[model samples]
Target: MSLSLCVITKNEEKNLSRCIESAKNIVDEIIIVDTGSTDRTVEIAESYGARIFYYPWNDNFSDAKNFAFCQAKGSWILTMDADEALSSVDKYKILPLLDNEDIDIYLFHTLSYMGSSPGVDTASNLNIRLMRNHKGYQYKGAIHEQICNVNQQLIDKRKVKIEDIIVYHYGYLDKAVAEKNKAGRNMKILERLLREDPEDNFHLFNMGNEYLRLREFEKALEYYRRAYRKFMPGLAHSPKLLLKLVMTLEALQMYEEELEVLERGLSCYPKFVDLEYLRACLFHKQKKYTLAIKGFKRCLTMEASPLHLRNINEVEGYRSYYALGEIHSELGDHEEAYDYYLQAIKAKPNFYMPLYRIAENLLKRGRNMDETKAALEKFFGKNLNAGAYGKLGDIFFSIGRYDSAYEYFLSAYEQMEPNPNIYYNLGMCQLYLKHYQEAYQWFEKIEGGRCCEDAVYRMALCEILSNHIENAERFIQLTPDHAYNKRSLVYKAFKNLAVGNPCGMLSDDKEESNAYVPIIFTLLNDLLKISAPEIFEKSLQLLNLIENDEVLLKLAKLYYCHGYYRLAYQEFVRSIQLFNKIDREGLRLMENIMDLSTGFTI
Candidate 1:
């Protein structure tokens, strides 16, 4: 009934200690087999009181593994590599599973965090690591090795439905794989195996995986096709092979082939969430959004199961929800998209992919600024990130709350450093707040990035607004000479007019006859299309109802977004003026008119 922990290692000083530490308390005996060690690997093993044995170096993994197993004294053997560890929960379940004689082998779900987003872990969910010594099980293959004739050896693998045990492996990470030259080493051995048995689907599959690790996606797809050609009839490893082919096809932008593979796989593995997810993703990529929405909804209906193909991906919850959000956002259903994005964020608080869509949908949802501000506050209270805080700052800045925007910009700076665009935003906040020195400092932080041109131009404006003529001359030299443009002239002229400089207003008239509102109306027009396309496309009908509160409110949002501050201010003022001439009992409506005009959040 005693268990032996068996490990095979070579130059594993960094990982040996952790692997031994996780098992020392549970196993009755610990065995370490080293082919060679030029580090403290053997010493660390000896320190843990493990029985150490040495074998001559041969570039064969299964041979080394089988050699270690033959030396085990306990009735059952638990084997893991030096770079792998059993999680705390899995460690506790080992003794109970080892005590039960009903199962001949224990399979662990190996979680590998190696995808594009490495933080979101996935697994193969079917690794045979624990088995009875008397079962006479031995390893096979020279690389990416596994039990010889696994289906024949572990015929009763489905008898126990235990999914709690897990092995966290770090070796597949980009850094780890590159350092070990693992892909190259695996490629050499797998090619040798294929030469010996040209019809071996398992060897073909192994070769495909090695190329995938090296990012030779086209070659990987070719090998997957060869393997699947032989194995498709039996559907042996259909889940793993189909996932590999589809992912490679995606990398090659072959959405049609990807869909074909997924559909074929789904016919056999009907309830597979990962297949459904990839199908939905391809539909989204193809701009078939309505179909993508259907695919994503189907993903959520799938039950959570330990069944996984080559890649362990769970789509029954947040992943599916996030995809749905993306589809709705693309289709211009901003409100529905926002709701799905909120649910995705709720499902996984640390997952940041959904956060940007939430912020973006909030900005363009056609809601009043008050509602947008309220949602931003709620989101930032729960999750503080650069996007959320920056968008909130943008909303406040648009609505003329410069002081409030300044505070949120500071919060955003903490999360996203070295972002020159946010620096420009902070400078704009300071400039409008009349903190010229502070705004100058923020603008100076930009050197040569995305917003550098705009920052330099704004620096010149800050100088002109402050009446620092000498500083303005210096900024004129430093900037791209944008201050000489008619847009800049109009901005400066109207701004001075607002500050009670009648001479400044006359100066604009003398400089050019064109009106300021007409010059910058395009910026306002663009905002209308982005934020409220329905109202923008049918503006003739809406504009005729100038006396309507809803029309005035929508116009205000567009003007605010476009930096037509003075003109927008005049419209709000006119709304109030017209309201006063109409009714006396509707003071509340008058107050709302004043609020919209005066940039007051209501």
Candidate 2:
């Protein structure tokens, strides 16, 4: 039997060619129905020798798709979206499935990519893409369309499942969604449908899903609750509705409510690993480690089934392992944590969190940096490219191991083309090491956007630290007027100090101060380490302007931890003067130190 590939389009110039090219060799004819074409969609269709039909834009997907299906002339019909393509493995394997006369329809696994890159964070579902032509099958619904029979009812065909048949869909990706304005269009259509039938749970559930994707949690929760109240257990989307509701509640931090819904969902779908995974996550959040561990272990016992339309496959493997690792780490079972983290890495090599944890633990234990690098390199096998090296550098940078980070960044830079992020990372490492001129040169290489702005600021600060006051002022003046530039607390404090008047640099804006004070403190401390005693003394005057006792107390502890006894003592005295009873334990420690000093009394 010959097959006709049917697709409906509207200005799908970017995606139409891919869709047609993927199935052209397997199908007898390509039938394209264009609702509207403000671009080269129709031209491209003609170039592919497709039998093209024109239909007016009526804002109804089912109607447009049904029109396309009716025009198919082959014995069998295969329908697909403009943004979807048949997988190479399944392209040549379809005709055999059609040889079975008992099957009226074929359900293919549809993998919807959620990000720019393929095979990363995909949502999978089963979809009816193939059916006998002239079987009176047509699509229904205006927005999230479904298949129906001649009687305009949901189709109840003899269906065959072919797990090997796969379709890759890219319309849901963030960039694609934004370019198509899909969310706005879908919300409009769904809202119109909801107004006509306010209590329609299917539409309500879809509305919740749309809002959830848009990250409007409160609105998503509202629609999800409405759908849950209706709770049509027999419907295909009912289980998904409950899952989405729990996820919405989780996003909103309504954990108690999420647990209630999860328990209800688990009652209905006892083996749904996603629900169990979420339950474990909630338990982990609440520090109920025993329950969380049991739940996560239960998840690992089940395999992820594609029958669950929204099954996140990782929940049954790496995600659970990672969660277990986090729990073990929290409980201080470092050895157990390390084992689970390694298992997680083994499950998904590109998953970097486990690698991060392992590296952090090794560094914290004072393990040799070279040995740690060797351990991490084993995960990449023989394919440790420049990008992988950059990722390693990023992980070390995140954990404040700038020396190790610099080494990796240098390795990445040597092997790769020019990259602004690598330059910025290198600059930051040098800046932290008090190599101002080297940092300035690295920062100078960055050219555009927010990273450029930050690099410029750092360059100015580097010049200031190197005593090139004129060059520093010139660099500062070149920056745009933003909080990180002139208005920043660091800039304001430094400017005041440069002018020999550091007393009034602190602003009365507590929120602004809270956000920027630590940055200023770190900068001043770094300057002090480089033997800038004059700037260090001026920074003390700036600190005196900050009247927050908590800030002063934290600074004292930080200073004491770094072995700056005189600075720590000064901060402790100031902290005590600000709050009479705070940090008493710290005070007792100081007194003990003083008593020991008396052994050298002259």
Candidate 3:
């Protein structure tokens, strides 16, 4: 039983060598069908001793692949792509699987990496990649091609799953997708295919997949729903469709609908632990702690679903353990939360979330920098790297340890090249430590990176705090107009105060006031810590513009709680006079103020 590796290529010079080298020992012949390459793809194939066949560029992927298959001359065929490689451990298993006579075709688990980096997150699916040649097996579909027979029927029942033989596909990595314009190309092909057959379930599902990849969630949901209406259980993509539908609904904030679809999916494939993990996450989002805990614990007890059914890795181990830790943390069970976080670290030593949590929890419990660092070292052993240190710095910054966080962040930057996150964190640490000029310098390094807008906002604050009013106004103008940032009551108030345009605060309406009244007080208190007394007075004036008794009272309560008696006295008096009411807390505050002033209670 000889295996012929057949691949169709177009400008795949970067990846073809790896693909061929991985399979060189196992395959008898390499067949390369070029679809009009303008690069060294054919040259690379020639160097590998591959028998090259030239095929003209066609819009249909199935046509190109079928042409490649027709040129193969071996008894068994293995389909491969230039961006994929046979797993080193699993490559040898393929030849042994080809010897099985009863199975005409074999399915291999394809691990497709997501994001710009590999091994961080992946999605797995089974594909019919190896099959007996001369059995009339052919490729179908225009874009996301499928395998069919001479009569155009799927070869489903004759296929056997070989778990030991795996394929690692790198074409879906974010950088690769962007460089090759795969989403745009796939969208164009899928659209043309859908136009030809509007009711084709496979086309609709693939169209949904393209939209989902592009993050056009609403459009994705529409196509997914349409495809799901005609979904067949026997189709290989059925599970993927269900999972994507649930994810899209969740993205659209249609939680109720998401749960409904999740239940239906679970009913169909109860062993899909990833879906159960998602259900637990949804429960946690909705604050249904009991159900969330139960679901997560169930994930811990259950094994992984079959490779064909697995959408994500570690659903039953580190991911679930980390999630349980978060749930316990939210429930205020610190000890239990700490225990779960430890277990999560044990399960996946390099998982950053639980490590950050453990560090933050230790600091919150009054552990000093030395103790916190010792604990983290114990948990991570010798596996900690620059990325881990950066995360640890973020946790320290979160708990108000600016000096320690700054040290760790600087160390991380020294160990690794300075990225936008470290720049932002280092700038924030300096900002908090009141080294305004140093903070500005760090923020300046974030030129066009992911944290540019946030850095610009901090740059404005740095200028304002340093009394460079003109520079502050310029930076404020440069701040990105994100709705969540621009429309923030605190942000608006700060920008106005920085520009000396106190009337800019007047544009905030009752709706903004009503929505922000609960938390705005604490935000204002933080603002007061960084601003002058004049700015604090201006904030009071803005509060008066809202005409909210609750807002002023809450502000006064925050001041009193934090022992700012003078500020509390002013707020209490303002609230009492403006709203014409006084609660017991206000009366006590007034009495305390009077006692402080004259040694007598009012």
Candidate 4:
């Protein structure tokens, strides 16, 4: 008289027995309606003494489930699936709910396990699994079927509570999900539902979920947007649909649109921390650090509440610390960043990214080099993904530690899945270190990929700088042989200066503008070292045609670096005349550099 567990089965032979076994003590009666099982599913159910009835194979899940519901003699009905089981903790919490006559429905939280090297528990979803049988409650829809209680007014939080009754779901594991082909099957049914009532946002939202599962983000966005527009105007719109739609927008990198959606939904669903967390990420990506900080901080203030019907993938505890740490680190707040990164490590000891970043932040601060080395040692052993290692390399590279950067990048290349970008970075570090021949070898290792053009261009620079003029020209010819862009042009000019010729004619104004000071300041400094009188003469002549303040300022720095204090002083004097045209920041930078370069000629 207490609880009747209702289940619908197909060829669930492998799963039915375990599911029934787990439910034996939880429910008084087991009512299973089989839709055609060729396996030992029925035999296993019989061993559990489940009252089984046959319904000819109908693709309609709700039909079969409703048939089982009708046969349940208990006062309350509990709908369950063959792939799910009640958690031990939840089993105890649920028993007390059955005796409460005032409660008409109960929402059970379902936790799915994602199949990977080590299975991960996904987010929680509240399902109407338990309700009074006298309320005329039955199932609806074919796929992702739901309970439609006739006494819907009693579904408020006061009468219906979401208990901590966890249902562990294995339907999303790699083998199970693929074997079931959930997305493919659901899409077919959802399309039919859409065709019948084209404007029905319910079907549209479901279609979006199927495509989202399959990673067809553009299609998902199309349907999610259509559904959002249809349902958003009314007070009865589903919070889950809006949240899922926002996720689709994020997958598409439509951050601006996602921000808009989040703002619209947050007012309606303020308690949803998942939305707040995503809003924080979106803000961080867009570099709105202040707003992002606020959003992340808000997540810490929320109590544990129900997330939407999608995968419960949001980090439950202090996971936002990792993101907050990244934002602080970018804003140059090392103290705050270091603290958050440590907190993140505490929250998830196995998480590799924060460990890697902690090393980077410590190294940047230069105060805790020993700790930085230790963190890197731990990270190197725990992670094989190239991104974390590559990022560490980038941090070193930015701080003028060429040898260290090259070593990290090479380590990344050695263990990573043969990505050409890592190869490109190795070549780039050697180029910065002025090991031209060594740089060429790294670039030569990659034969093809999206980074090929960039690698070839750098390789050509190496060849030209190493005095292999013919090889340089050959490498350049092998490339996309269009007009020289900024990088290629600067390197080509250096080649001309090296070969006792003038920096050749540029392709266009765009190419000329592209040769920024940072790209070739080192090349220019090297060219000034050439003892040949003609080379220095041509270099001076090259500067005559380019009279920008940046060039003049960089020339001053070059002169200072090589002890031409008088030449540097003269250049700085000339640069100051054009300082009015620059921004305030640029003006201050020029003055600071001029002061540092000022000295008597040696």
What is the C-alpha local distance difference test score of each model?
0.71, 0.81, 0.81, 0.73
TM-score-sorted candidate list, best first: 2, 3, 1, 4
Please estimate how well model 4 matches the true structure, expressed as its whole-model Cα lDDT.
0.73
Give the poorly placed runs of model 1, Cα more than 4 Å off.
115-118, 148-162, 233-236, 306-310, 366-602
Select the stronger candidate by lDDT from 1 and 4.
4
Off by over 4 Å in 3: 43-49, 151-159, 382-391, 394-400, 412-428, 440-465, 468-602
Report the Cα RMSD per candidate. 15.1, 7.4, 9.1, 12.3
TM-score of 4: 0.59
Q: What tens-digit string does per-residue lDDT give for candidate 1 at 1-602?
A: 79999999888887888888888888999999999889999999999999999987688998898899989999889999998888876787888787675777777778776854347765555777788886667888787676653446455655444455778877777777777788887888877888899878888887888888778988999899898776563544667878888888888777777888889888877767788888988888766777888998987887864444435556778888888888887678888888898888888876766655665576677666467557667866877678878877876766566777888898899888688888888887887676777888999999878788667656765665566655755665564544665455543443333244432231223224333344334323532423434323332231331123333444554565564555455555565665433222233334434545556432
* Estimated TM-score for each candidate: 0.64, 0.80, 0.74, 0.59
State the displacement of the C-alpha of residue 578, model 3, in Å, after optimal TM-score superposition: 22
Candidate 4 structure quality by residue, lDDT tens digits, 164-228: 67787778777787888988878888888778889787778889888888889999998888887
Clashing pairs in 1: 240-310
Best-performing candidate as measured by TM-score: 2
> What TM-score does prediction 3 earn?
0.74
- For candidate 1, the lDDT comes to 0.71
Model 3 residue 253 CA deviation in Å: 2.5
Structure candidate 2, residue pairs in collision: none
Model 3, residue 283: what's the lDDT? Answer: 94
Please provide, for model 3 over 519-579, each residue's C-alpha lDDT reduced to its tens digit, 9 standing for 90 to 100.
Answer: 4564465455444566556656556556455666777777776667777788788777887
